[model samples]
Target: MGYIILSIPVFFLLIGAELLWSAWTHRKVYTFPDLIANIGCGIGSQVVGAFTKAAIFGVYLWTYDHLRVFTLPANVLIWVITFLLVDLGYYWFHRLSHEVNFLWAAHIVHHQSEEYNLSVALRQSWWQGLFSFWFYLPIAVLGVHPVVILTVGALNTLYQFWIHTRAIGRMGWLEHVFNTPSHHRVHHGSDPKYLDRNHAGSLIIWDKLFGTFQPEEEEPVYGITTPLRSWDPVWANFHYWADLVALARRCTALGDKVRVFLKPPGWRPADLGGRERPKEHDRTNYLKYSTDAGANARRYVLVQFFLLLAVTSLFLFKQDSLPIWGAWVLAGIIVLWVMGLGLVLEGRRGALTLEAVRVLLFTGAGIAVWMSVLGWSWWCAVIIFLGAASMIHLTALSGEGEVAGQ
Candidate 1:
């Protein structure tokens, strides 16, 4: 997670380059709402990961402490072997995420984006970091040092970031060994042939060896089987789980209820319609989900979202310094701010109300800080001023937003 945080700047730079290429070529690879929502999902995931990551890593550390068969030296060759093992662990965790229903519920957010770009790499699941460490415990148990496990794991993550783009074509020979952009594009595809192929972090050999590899035959249609049709990051995280729970409730048999989570997604009960074969979805004339939000609403969303990103970054950097409860509180605020931004992007009617509530929270936090100091704090004063400005902008643009929604 620290590695990912440090690389956020590079991610945006690459994303910006992709945008420029799109504009220069008129390829229509990005939409404003989709870009915001993708980054929003990433931000929310990082913020959530901060609260739970230390304990999860502690489990790996505990396994290393207690279960090693032989003490392994952290030599150069050992580093290489550990890197391979960590990536292999990631591959299984990723493949299983797509296969099992419950895991998919945690992972499906990353694939919800209809557009594939560098930004898509950052569109992670908030809870996925929780489940992946279990898969890495085996490496820890094999006498691999915890430091090696973590460093290589972070490297594997960083390596995959550049693969989430259409800006680059096939890397010829490299495509055969490493997971290149072409391989990853197929993984993101919703086309029947590409549904579950190419589940690798950095190496493509795992997919080839396991018979899950699919070369790019045609331009692939990206996103999940069913379109999310939403910009709400909060909904992006939990919608699949909600869908699974709803399906389970509809199942009369107890076994079917359990299977709803264990089985592959779209695996309905016999009475509910059994497994859904992936139908052939063509790339021709496919339209991604979007909204016709007014200019004021769009600008407000854009500005506020950047502000949210700043605060989220600060929270991630200082989470360990603050009390656990304080960290959680800060995370909740950031998450709500992200949700509100998403709602505003979608031109939802009640978004302004949500924004108003968020503004009040911001104001309250600033007040708390101000009172604690018994005087002015520059940052607190800025927060109050920003909250007032946000409300004014919302007031000024309410009519335009309603018009756009209509």
Candidate 2:
């Protein structure tokens, strides 16, 4: 219920606004394929995880009906301790996801993109829920209420959002202990030495203690060793799985088969057999250069962000009965989906048509909000109708997001 209520329109609204603002800003180019694939994967994985969490919690509640485990203290100290421990649990799950092959398969999606943006945070793996939730079972077994776990998880996620940007540099001593943008950036790098390093989610201590730590030595190269190479969301989500499965089948020995899939990014089946393996070119500096398609896409994302803020505030003012807080929450989701669409269609010429439709719909919605605030009758209805029409048109144009003059 929380996922549906919080995710649906709210998610779309924030992401939509972000994309509009991103396009308008013209700072960097973003890819529609990257945007779309990332958002699709994010939503799919999150929704699936949400459902699994709820079902498991329900089962726990039924089994332990008499357990009175909501022992949250009245003091602020207890709350702080709980929050810190939740971060520790997340760190374990996150670090393990990097060390274990099956876990890495689910996590690699987030590191697949070359660009770093808020949307990149949404580029989650579809299979991550298959195992990540298991790490949290101990909390339930210890009788922490499911509601508390979910709330802390959401807070942990929200806290991570600010760390996903190049816009924020490192903070002196804080950089050494916290997972700041600089350290996190190194974690996402594809540079040979930087691979499988710095796997902190909310805290940096896990990486430090477990010796999975590597500081940002070189300016990192982002994305996977075997790039997904396509904007298709389905492909981005499953390509690694396919590669691992295929490599497993081709292995002559059972141990070699399992080892090949579980080894580091550049490892091959022949490595264990002392046979020659195919050489790969160094992509050390690939992400440094700028692409025209990338520039346009980033511009689109900037435009979406500002537009979301502007229009959402406008809507809140017009609908005086709606809470002010809800407007900001709505704005975040709109920005996310917009970035998602932009990434999914990157390098395709069809993005222009979608942009046109998005602009028209938003313009109409803005006007309607203004009209309602000015006491215009039936204006809100017109806005709704036009907004729906615009979205439908945009949906139709989405297929052509990679093509020009469509």
Candidate 3:
């Protein structure tokens, strides 16, 4: 989480650069609602991780303490081995996330966006940390210190962020060895030939060695075969699990119910239908998920999103010093703030009402948090000003149009 918090500035800088590139090139790669959803998911993931990450890492700590066969030194050679091992683990973990049903429930959020850009890379699942830690436990057991594994892992993750772009073309020779933007774009692609291909983290050689590599030839359609069709970040993270549960409940046989979760995604019982395959769609005819929003509504959502981003950054920076309950309280507010912004952007019924309530709640909670520190008065003033402006915007928009129902 510290790695991510420290990288937030860099993330925004790169995202800004990409936005400028898209505008200057007239490519129009981003949509406002999609950007909101992407950033919301990223912040939500870190919020959830604040509480759950320690426990997840505790499992690896236990593995290292109890099941160690060799104690490697903290040298460059050991770091290289650790890096390769973690990447290998990520490769298989990533592959299984696409192949297995339960894992895909968490992994699918990253691939939900139809638009491919830097923002899409931030659309991560809130619950992936809960499941993905198990895949890297082997490196810990090999006697590489947990800190080293974490540092190297952060570097590995940071390496992948740049590859999520569409601006960069194929790198001449690096495309063969590393996961370049070209290879990663193919991974995010939903085309028939591109599904479940190129599952690499920092290196692309793993996919080639394991027979899961696919080169980009024709332009690929972006997004899941089944479009999510909504901007709700919370729903994006858990909707697949809800679908799996619904399918399992419909099954009468015990084995079929169990297989609903264990089998690959799109799997269906024989009694219902044989294995479902990826549907082919014309690449040129792809329609992105969107909703109608008045200019003021769009501006409101954009402003609120940045406000929430600032609050989220402060929470991350001060989390260690804050009390447990205080941290959780702030996390809850951030989550609601994110969800409220998504609802506002989606034009869901009663969204304005919800946003109004969220504004008041966040303002009250934020004032309480700031009162304990210096400059509380000025902070309180800023909060009230922002909250008042948001309320005004919502009130103004409420009279102009009806929110479309999802």
User: Which candidate wins on lDDT?
Assistant: 3
**Where is model 3 poorest over a 10-residue stretch in terms of lDDT?**
370-379
Candidate 1 ranges beyond 4 A from true positions: 366-376, 399-406
lDDT of 1 by residue, 240-345 (tens): 9899999999999999999999998879988988888988875566888878777778888888988887777777776666665566667778888889988888
Give lDDT: candidate 3, residue 76. Answer: 96
Comparing 1 with 3 on lDDT, the higher-scoring candidate is 3
Evaluation by lDDT, superior candidate among 1 and 2: 1
Clashing pairs in 3: none
Ranking by lDDT: 3, 1, 2
What CA RMSD would candidate 3 show? 1.5
Per-model TM against the reference: 0.96, 0.64, 0.96
Per-residue lDDT over 331-384 for candidate 2, one digit per residue giving the tens place of the 0 to 100 score: 334443453454424544544554565556455544544453465666666656
lDDT of 1 at 172: 85
Q: Comparing 2 and 3 by lDDT, which wins?
A: 3
Model 3 Cα lDDT, one tens digit per residue, 244-305:
99999988899999999999998998888879988888757767777877687888888888
